[model samples]
Target: MICALTGVFPVTQARAQQAPLPEGARIVVPGHGWGHGRGMGQWGAKGLADQGKTYTQILSTYYPGTTLGARASTEDIRVLLETSSDVIASSDQPFTARWSNNSIIATSDATYRYFKETWDGTNYHGGSIHVYRGAIEAHQGGSSINSINVLTMQQYLYGVVPRESPASWPAEELKAQAVAARTYAARRKDSSRAAGSSYDICVTTSCQSYGGYGTKSSPTSSVTVLESSSTNSALDATAGKVLMYNGSPILAEYSSSTGGYTAASSLPYQKAVPDPTDSVSPHHDWTASMTVSEIEARWPSIGRLIDLTVTQRNGYGGWGGRVLQMNIIGTKGTTTLTGYGFMNAFAWPGRSNGLQGNWFTPLYWRGVLQSAPSAVTMYAGESKTISVRITNTGTASWPVGGNVHLATNSASSFATSTWISSTRPASVARNATDPTKSSVGPGQVAEFHVPLSAANMPPGNYSQRFALIADNQSVTSLAFTVGIQVLVPWVSEAPNLLTNASFEPSTYAWR
Candidate 1:
């Protein structure tokens, strides 16, 4: 196995090669830790518990001289942690609850130690605490609320607001002790304390892992260095404190004993670029073409065909972590057209890192057809009936409880064409995916019967356009063109010098 940088070899070892380090040269410390020496030492904690140190003693040793008590009363607290977008409805307690404060603390009884606390600003609210003794659990709240409302390692670090418990914390005020412990470890974010601080990654393969055994965890055994401090230091040490790795911030990682790693780059919340490997980020720019033949071939008989080709720097944009809309341009000789849509791919541009980019067009609506006549023919005054078939080909389906519309070119048709069938679709038949007719699947067809108007249309090579607009999916302009022509009469000379003419109707009108 080998690791390299800039074509320069660094770490390498052959399966049968002799170890190369000198007698005293150690690449890594023999001790089983790569982080701070305080609080929950992880590996060290396991070792300690193996030697039989109780969890209560473990907490006391880390916090030093602190009292454990019950949670205070319950009142809602507005919590804002890590600048996250989610807001959870929570409460605060003076002794037992958790709260969001620059500084505060509280504790619970040893018997009910397993606890979790979250706070907004005002009060400290707490939940069941989970702690371990030796191989056995000292406190397992399970579904019971009887457990003490003590702060977990996280709550203790973030700081909690303390208030009066339902019963007075008469003996040793739990809140004050929690605050003192929090402040002790709070300044680790300062650059000057890099040696003492550590970074914590999101709880995934993107981060460092805690290689502990089994499901039950000792509260003291699982403590880890906070992310804020470590990430900031790495960022500060970078050329301009703007950490970079191959021209981008080096993402920090945290691993759970379970599997894989999770990572987070050192970018500010404002205008921060997405992780390079993120499916939503743009690694390179590329262009795609939808050929003219492709569209024309899809539907023939239309003389004018337009095709659009798009060129984009990269495929990254949109909400719900999707690609940006791509603008397409179609040009046929002197005619040009433009449209917007998206694309899906198995990978991104630039690198060959095996990440798949699944892109597709957003939802489209079905268009309805409306015209004066249902059908038309190339004739002068011959009344004919034709059925107009319309299809909803939008990416989305149509509404079940809403009416599909059909209109005639006549301005007074709205009042006179009340007899036209434009009833709301049956609600029972609505698709479960969408209640609104916001989507219309491809090839789903709808039809309407219309009467052809032959009297007003002067059949002399005339044509009219029918338009269709989808209810909620998308708006489309459809032209159903039918050509019509009127036949001319023939005149002949009769006896007595009088001119007689006769007109004969023909079924076919030649243009």
Candidate 2:
């Protein structure tokens, strides 16, 4: 197949003949949304709250068909705060600690240690000995250290609400967050991400950011005044309430932003929905620019990357869907991977960051900016022009900053004398928008006005292909074709060399 580019011959080949990706091509992937778009978008919540929507209204919008559920009175949860050898526990008020029926009392100055002989999941539950509010338990689990914070769901959320969502946000927003955090904690079952770890949920993104009872992080006491009054009030406003789907707390996953649309989940309530107010988020729309060379470096097995083809998407909003499966084609071989797998590959040495989300589209470098006339018709000596557009897709812009030309091929018979060579037509015209630009730059589209003349050719039909060239090397082989029907010049005025000069003319001339 005649692979992509401009030349003298008509590019009669099918679209499959488009050239392979330039090895050093630059690609810009414009994307929408930020995180793993499942569940509610935190920014959307803040925006809704600011618009006078109640927390219940915001929650119902995100988690469709979910209602507030009742929680057990004085429910408690365990949050993994830290991991260290020396476990320390202190409290301003005298608190009691017991392990295996052995109890000890300690006040603020004189601290006491609670050692769990075995984490039977029930032996040491809460540090609340009269007022263990300022207590953090550092226990030993199988030769490793794990500092667990045991507190009532309400108080724990008092610390978590402000940390997950900024404490300075609106009251309704914080209340929504408080309810989400509470639901997330109440429904927690297993969060064993590491060996010898025995905690219901660790205070990290894996579960959610929980700021013990005091500070933003662990190894700190639950200082009441240290907590945000705003967050505490928000928690109080939405006390003992969790999102219920089917008689249980629904998994109310949340992230910093959802771009525009929340991702769908297996859960019935976590369906993909539009988040219009999410525009308040900085990550709502984003772009990631890169080169094909870096892609090759990431997947050495693929040699040089030839192309990236997204095969399947989830079929939702913005770009129609999120990439589900794609093919990474290269010189050595082709690798098929799911959308997440492709993202994981970007974590290699060169790629600065992974793609924000699967919802992205590699955008236009150059293409048929304006289509050439569907047909061309002209008489002898008449001129018809075609526009060719090009962009800097490879190592350098057209002509390598020298001068790029939209030229004809060696065999094209339609080449006019004005052509640079029998094949080369003219410098690719200036930027489509600016006339002064002489060469196409990166991400810029330059036009070329190819003058087709019919003066020298016989009138049947003609076809020629054009391509972009710079520095004597082929910039793009993806040629465009122009077909013209050159008819004989129409007769307007004609002179006749009359034989007898209208009969009397010969006699008069002879006289």
Candidate 3:
């Protein structure tokens, strides 16, 4: 992922080293690891192989206590090649296809053929190309559909292993990856049915990366045939082997790197283990620096972020620990987020400023509440409007509609009827220069207002308790007094010590 940075921050090292950042400036954060940090670490596997570990040893270390067994390769698997309204099905040599009308047509050595529904054909080597099982629907360009390849599990791995891991890696590592990929694909053989398609898996990273037939036209055609030959050897060597526990294939998930330690896994076979070999990976440890203002732009509801802390961690706790929960303390309130939640809060696909993995150090400024409305006094059945100005001292943006709101608390004395004309108990809007703008960026003020009333209330002081609502949840509470004074009716008469001083027609007198 790439990030764009601008503004007055120094560019030259000499200038940056000479001057300190202005007080309250945002700090830079460094991060480590990559991917989800789950299952087999490809770099870690390579490290283990370099140390002369065999394929079985590597697999045993990653997926502990699993047995290697063979399954029949007769079961065919479907792999989605591309999604288009129309697809061209071809082979290196002449092939025959069966159409939807149950008609078999033999082609005169055509490189490709267009089809809509089912079209079953064969390659020069007698391998079958099945395009019949998925939707024949088109998106975008119109009149296009997706193409699928039907082949044995073994043949699918021939294209997958090379695309996922480098073909030049040690043979033992390649074999381990081949088995892992095969097992991963085998377990999801029924996925196509659930997805209402004919193919069981896709050709993207969402599934195992697959490029069919080692051809330039393959989805991942960048890989050369020579490079694929090495991985092909690994697939042949492993044949139908898969790591099994209790007579079933394990999930067999894998990623690029695990930094120094694997993530704690719930599955007994996918346990955490030290991967010192993965140190060779460039992303094993990395640093990312962003201004506090930049981070605040993402989470404005937290207010001016004063501090960020890891409140919880998985069983693995340390420099490489996986954060289970985090708390963002701002001037307005503290926001708690889960590990995955924290990732999504900042990192989006194709966007930068996100951690590579859950492991990282955070440095930020605390958010602050700058101002609040004063206590209001109103007669019973009267209304008074109030506003509170809050400053986001933290590193997240206060979003317009969802993250910033005024919510009455349980201890609030006023009933829903006390709010002047609104149906909801509380009404909130963003503090924008133009009423139409929605968000309050970092270092900006969010002004919340509502018409408070004292209708149908006894004559006494009551605390109208409220809290700031962010991300559709309440973060903290505040309160102000609303004194609902009695409406004393009086009559003008000769001064008596406790008598009303003036009245035209008094409805009631002070008791």
Candidate 4:
């Protein structure tokens, strides 16, 4: 749940009115899940494995309607290792460097040097050298150059699987990871080439974590090399295997965890699904808080802070649902932010360590009566237009069909028709243009106007309340009250016809 960290106030309205939020009130938000909440959840897979589910079952659950398919192993993939003007190419044993222009260049044993252009094939210490297959191309980047490794798809998976999922994980889980990573890599290979890049994918998180040769060395450093036997075995087991949908390699997107339910996506395979095992993940649930001042600092247009509400959600059906849209309400105006935008807004330091995922509950007041009709005295049988400005200060959007009407109180002294009885109920309309028709979204205000007629009212003062209604239910928290005084039109005594005549004792006695 997301809670605004504004200053505390009394529980009762009267006391809350006496103690207002101090200057610079804050908003605190807490949330759940992690990553993009898409595709195969690593932790969920682990959970399934722990529950004795096979790798095939786990894959089928995450990637619905996908089938295991075989692809040609002949197609090679290009991976961008490093980008720099100078690249150190070395090997333990002497190797031949064949240039792109069909030039043969021999390298000294155990030495690193820079090469200007492309090479036909650089073989080092047999297959002991873990650079890449095919040829290594040194493409010129802006003011520098990039070192690309063109190799078979299988060789690329050897560097990717271990980094994406732990090599020590269950053999089935590792196999699942290998297949998914392979499928993902294959789909991106062609697209990357079409984009006019030297490599099919990068050796970073932008594509997938790829550590060449030894898994022990970092992507940035080319040091000691180490390989995990388990990961290598998984790669061999799933060689040339990929997840395919409609006879094509699917975009197999995977994340660390999905909390409990996967996110909704346009892809049919990425639909929302419940994973009971995701709870075992560390980032299954998390929370963060921030001040109103901090949020306002990021989005000053929100003006004086009021409340936050969730306007729309995806079809995932999780708590707070996967936030699709949100409304940030302030005294000056309201700002509508998409779920992703709202998460980015609180990405500031000490605000919310950033929203883990779009799934989170917005915990705050739903609406506020910013302006209400003042107490007025009107003659019995007269009419007055009573209007109130109500702002949607919650996390949810107020749809077009929602309504706002007077509250019911059978014990009230005043009769129901004493005020406005004709417009018994009113719908929440757009704050601007055609309030009677348009809908009031989150952070937006709706003005409810009712023509109050004192038709059969007695000479007395009365107080009435109104509330916002949605789904045929009254939003009691948003209810507001208005005051009215009805008076008789005439007095019993008649006025004397003596014009401009004054009587004694400073009292105007007319005769």
Best by TM-score: 2
What 10-residue stretch in candidate 1 is worst by lDDT?
254-263
Q: What is the TM-score of each candidate against the true structure?
A: 0.25, 0.64, 0.57, 0.61
Question: How far is 330's C-alpha from truth in model 3 (Å)?
Answer: 2.8
Q: Over the stretch 32-113, how does candidate 3's per-residue lDDT look in tens digits?
A: 5787777888999999999999988888878887899887766678776787665565444455665546575555655666
lDDT of each: 0.28, 0.67, 0.63, 0.68
**Residue 44 miss distance in model 2 (angstroms):** 1.4
Q: What's the distance in Å from true for residue 467, model 3?
A: 34
| RMSD (CA, Å), each prediction | 24.3, 13.1, 19.4, 15.4
- lDDT (Cα, tens digit) per residue for candidate 1, span 459-482: 355554444433322234343554
Candidate 2 vs candidate 3: the TM-score winner is 2
User: What tens-digit string does per-residue lDDT give for candidate 4 at 1-511?
Assistant: 3222222211211112111122343344556677777889999998888888888898999999899998777679988888877866664445677665767666555356777766688523322334443457676778887888887888778888888988888988998999999999989986777797767888888789987765213234464544478998988888888999998889999988787887757787877788779888987877655656666777788676566656666645454357777776666677887777877766533343567767776543256677666887888877776666677654445554344444343323333442243335444535643466466655677766555667778899887665554433323345566788889876534345344446566755432
In model 2, where is the ten-residue run with the lowest total lDDT?
Answer: 5-14
- Arrange candidates, best lDDT first: 4, 2, 3, 1
- What is the full ranking by TM-score, best candidate first? 2, 4, 3, 1
What's the alpha carbon RMSD for model 2? 13.1
Tens-place lDDT per residue, model 2, 1-511, is 1112211112111122123565555666767776688877899999999999999999998889899997863777777876767665555555666552466544445745778475555354344322234346666777778877777778777767777888899999998898888888877832332333456677778888765544222324343444688989998888888999878888889887787777776688978788889999877887666666677777778776655766666666654567677777777887887766765655222555446767776532333334553567888777777655654443334532345666675545677754645345566657765556665555566666677777677788877777655533334434577788888876642235254335443433321
Q: Residue 14 deviation, candidate 1, in Å?
A: 49
Q: How many clashes in each candidate?
A: 55, 12, 33, 19
